[model samples]
Target chain A: MSDADRVKVPRPVARFDDVTRRFDGGLVALDRVSLSVHEGEFVSVVGPSGCGKSTLLSLLAGLTAPDAGRVWRRDARPGEVGMVFQEATLMPWADVRANVMLPLTLLGEPRGACARRADEALARVGLDGFAHARPFELSGGMRMRAAIARALVTRPRLLLLDEPFGALDEMTREAMNDQLLDLWASSGLTCVFVTHSLYEAVYLSTRVVLMSPRPGRIQAEHRVDWPYPRGEAFRADPSFTHLRSALSVRLREDAVTPEGGAGP
Target chain B: MNGASGRAYLRWLAPLALAVAVVVLWEVLVHVFAVPVYRLPAPSAIALALYDGHSTLLESAWHTLSLALIAFVLAVAGGILLAIAFTRSRLVEAALYPYAVVLQVTPVVAIAPLILIWVGLDNAPLAVVILAWVVAFFPVLSNMTLGLRAVDPGLRALFRLYGAGAWQELRLLRLPASLPYLLSAMKVSAGLSLVGVVVAEFVAGAGTSPGLAWRILEAGNRLQTPRMFAALVLLAAIGVALFIALSCLERRVLSRWHESRR
Candidate 1:
């Protein structure tokens, strides 16, 4: 199809139309948040610690439903959507391959096919040689890589990651960012990543949506026009620094407001 | 073969040495005090009794062991199935868990006579198995229930995200997570099953079948203290064997990832 035809096609991988979620005791986790993610887009959500980024991902995963407004998922079914938690969340009793095979096994795929797909996923995550190793035997980063493999093994069209590298050190996090970018480039998956790091958001996301605290609502959306295969040089680039500081200033302004509210 | 085996050898050898010392001291005390055989038999006398009554004691031991094994198998099935039911349904658990607690707290000795009358004398061993099952069932149920509910929240959410069915969740996630708990409870129940069988046998008396407990009672009535000690030794041996066997099984299943095994 031509670019115009593709543009005319009403295809949205996910759409949040004025969604609001309120907890039992009147804590509003999200309020009137609206966003749309297209196919193969990398969207990063950045906010303060309690700004409902994880909750947004959970809503998208269908683990939780929005209390008000419509959340539309037009891309894939639950089994075709993959998610990574803040923690690695691996089954320690199972080895790397078995952990990665979990989704396929639950899907009732044949054993040999599950094993083959798990192997491929593990290899994609650079864990080919460690397929038989137990989760506890692997390092933290390796464990997270195994978890990523598990998410990818189902061949999901949409991948949701909730602060997956939050616990890692700076060096490992940077390496994982590059690895994740490479995977995204190859797989063409529409990814929604939630993180607190502005630098990470600028480095990895096509569009970064800033969220405000205390009833998380979209504050501002920043579009990063950086080209693919952005290397360490992009991190040192003046534009990268300027964007990071700009987002950081907005977050600082949000923090200074005494009522746990956001500035316009 | 070298240092590790040498250390392992010493580990058991130390306990064996202590047991030998205790036996020698008991022998010396009996001989020096000229104690009557009726009151307390010497280790030598117990050994001789074992030799003389080997066939009868062995037969009785086998009878008791068979009953315990039957009870153990039944208890395992009942406990695991019931625990699964409890985890799956709040209504079932609310209605029935109290009765399970009653079974746990009520002594098997207090119920063995009733079981005997209910099962009849022809099925005395079967009666013993029921009582043994009562004693052995609760640990597995409680431990497994806790294990099933103890699944990591994040992992549980992942399972939910994949839209895994209830059976799939149990089989692929809950069951594997609970193996450590189940194995630990099984180890505890192994010895309890044997004890329950023996106690039930004692209460039921020597009806249509004889067991090691009956042998002990008969020997005691006849004032054959040495023979009584031999029967007691056989019972202790069975308990030890059950414990060792179950422990080996637990280690095999749990050494990979369980914190306790590690």
Candidate 2:
């Protein structure tokens, strides 16, 4: 396809126009969900626990389907949806290299072809010399790294993360967020990061979509203006603090009062 | 209590001292009690019996070893085949597994004569002896199957994502995972196979292929207590040799990967 035919950057597209997702017992997980994510955009969706945050990812990855409406992506092909689950989903029996190489192998690439790429992917994730180490040998943070490597090995255009570091300690999670940001900036890949932490959402996303509880609906959306080359200082900014507190207030109101007031 | 010496090597002392003490106690007890040679022979008398009956004992020992070898091979073949079938599905495991348990649980002595009759073919008597070999074979298979499937789910998923087929998964992951279980099972089966051969001798006495079991029987009938003890010790020796060999193999293979090696 010609350059003109291709969609523009920062206009990277995820289409979920009028999407409605209903479970078996008429539990609506998503209602009329319409959102678009531009190319190379970092988007985080936050909600209370059991708010179908994971279900959104599942829909995007085609692991499950939306009950109504479409989730269409023009830039990414079907095979390019790389998903990282909440758990460190690395294969415990597989060494680091083999675990990362999994997507390539699943795509039916030859072993000789994937071998060096697998090593490179591991090295890229800071698991350079530990290529032969099993998942059990690695720490929780390291194992999550291996999991991320597996997702990136395929060079996916659209990455879907479902609370990827929710289980990690605060310090490790911060380190991971920086690493993830660096990777995202370097690779120029669009990401949909699902998180429960308001600070994390504000910290990582260029666009933050706050979701309301059970029968989930998007309560509001905010465009984060924190400049990139975003350092620890950006997190300490008054603007960052105000945005976080505002988002938390909106989330609290959405749950307890079942009413969403207009933003100031 | 938790000193470095607490983890000190315990090499050979326990067994060596136990053997020496047992021999010394046997000598003193027999001398003090004046136990007749026809009843329980002293260790020295048994040693003498071993010295005198060297040629005959060697012959019978060889016979017994050969029988046990053949029976063990049969058991291994049968066990491995059944194990493969069992691991394939819950249905196959349920159907074929129970009969194996029946084969094991039935007393060898009571069934030996009946097995001798039922063979109705050449080496039928030998076959009856081999029947005892079938006992405990599946324990190895059962344990091995458990080990093979015991791989972590995440690991299994990794393999799947790599597009590894069933054969590759089995060859690389399943079989290697099952090695410890297989080795332990081999240890148990090895000891049992030896016992099976000797028991067969008790049933099919004084035949051309009659083993140490026949010698044991003959010595007992003739009031040759020392000869009986000598044969028992030799059997014990064979069992020890096989057990030690299997243990070495287990250690050698696992030491590189397993922490228990240290």
Candidate 3:
């Protein structure tokens, strides 16, 4: 491509500088890991288990400080960022509306404002009718949607998702992928998704990052220049499967190392 | 649905039927054998005693019930506050938790005389309430501590991500999450508070306001076994009432959220 036709890179929203993390049992999670996510980019991290993919997201979300390196962000304060965990991570005592209001309430926002924001968020996730339902009373997919609504209530500029849809079946997972993309497009939020599925990473990410086994280090980075509003047909495209296979090969190579992958 | 309702009816009816049968059998045996009133009062004689000594028994019961309730309220408040303190600071927990354990392990009856002497006769009920509070406090403290610590790590991380301060964390997350544990502890302490107050009253000896325990002792000393039996019935009723009340509260609070209640 000519220099004039080259893609423009957005300013980095977050940067990790050689972050290292170690546990008490002499387990190294991340070692000298360096990466950056640009503004409004959908970055998916795919790796084998125990490869510190979740740890990277945690650092970016500022849930845990790195043991060694610095995690730099673009002036994102606590309420300016949102997170969705693997499980819903909802308070069982609270209903859907109350759960969505959690972040705003914690910020000590006025009740009327918090309630309005929560209602708006729930409606955005298509969960308006289920706002009064308890978390346990909802189906798994519905619960996850509520969780996403909770993550979005703060109107966060950055959203961190750790395997947010890993538990859903294929159909539901695909539907959620579309929904997530719609949400991401409309809000223009920077997102970092951690997952084990290569297809999922290829399907949703503007860029896919691969990491090696334990003491996770960034192995490779691939960019997908697919246009916005990618439909179901994209999953059937030869290019989609081609990219997934390339990413899968990178994962398998590290998974079957001299020492087997992380224990079940 | 009809079968389920039948089963529910039986659940209540079975115990009541057995209690009636036992009372009937006891009455028959006492009347047939002509057992001494002091040794074992007949069910009819006990019923008569209940009717005759209604005022005295009720007044003493009210005193004991009020004391136990006061202690229970105090215990809930103190235990929850201490538990919050413990969760916030490990240093405070490390220094004070052992002493709380000591208080729990020490027998209230053994210390009742000293408590009465220290607090004086006019405030004997207060001393009894304090003793009941000691018995009731540990369960709440320990349960609340466990509940606070048992918060899901994922949820805790989410709270931290939102910049929830310690106080907000406790109020919005820890306290609500710990409701089941706290309720269960309250149920346990409800019974223990009654036991502590009765034992303390017995140890405190007869003050101006004789509580249920003191009345029971007076009846036993006078060989009014029927009156003593009536007093025992009142004590049992109080315990059952408190247990049922707390259990209902627990169910009402937790049925919507807690798996156990559901």
Q: Top model by DockQ, which number?
A: 3
lDDT of 3 at A248: 89
lDDT of 2 by residue, A108-215 (tens): 779987878888777778989998987777888998998888888878888889899999999999999999998898898889999999999899989999998767
| C-alpha lDDT (0 to 100) for residue A175 of candidate 1 | 97
Which regions of candidate 2 are displaced past 4 Å? A1-95, A102-108, A133-138, A158-169, A192-201, A206-225, A241-264, B1-8, B54-81, B118-133, B159-164, B177-184, B204-208
Per-prediction TM-score to the true structure, in the order listed: 0.93, 0.77, 0.95
Pairs that clash in candidate 1 = none
Model 3 per-residue lDDT tens digits across residues B136-227:
99999999999888999999998899888888888888999999899999999999999989998898857555899999999999999999
Q: lDDT per residue, candidate 2, B207-243, as tens digits?
A: 5445788888888898899999999988888889888
Residue A136, candidate 1: how far off, in angstroms? Answer: 2.8
Off by over 4 Å in 3: A1-7, A260-264, B259-262
Pairs of residues clashing in candidate 2: A12-A38, A12-A39, A92-B155
Candidate 3, residue A52: CA error in Å?
0.4
Top candidate when judged by TM-score against the true structure: 3
Across A150-263, the per-residue lDDT of candidate 1 in tens digits comes to 999999999999999999999999999999999999998989999999999999999999998888888899999999999888998999999999999998887668474433
Candidate 1 reference-contact recovery? 0.68
TM-score of chain B, per candidate?
A: 0.95, 0.90, 0.97
Report the CA-based lDDT of candidate 1 relative to the real structure.
0.91
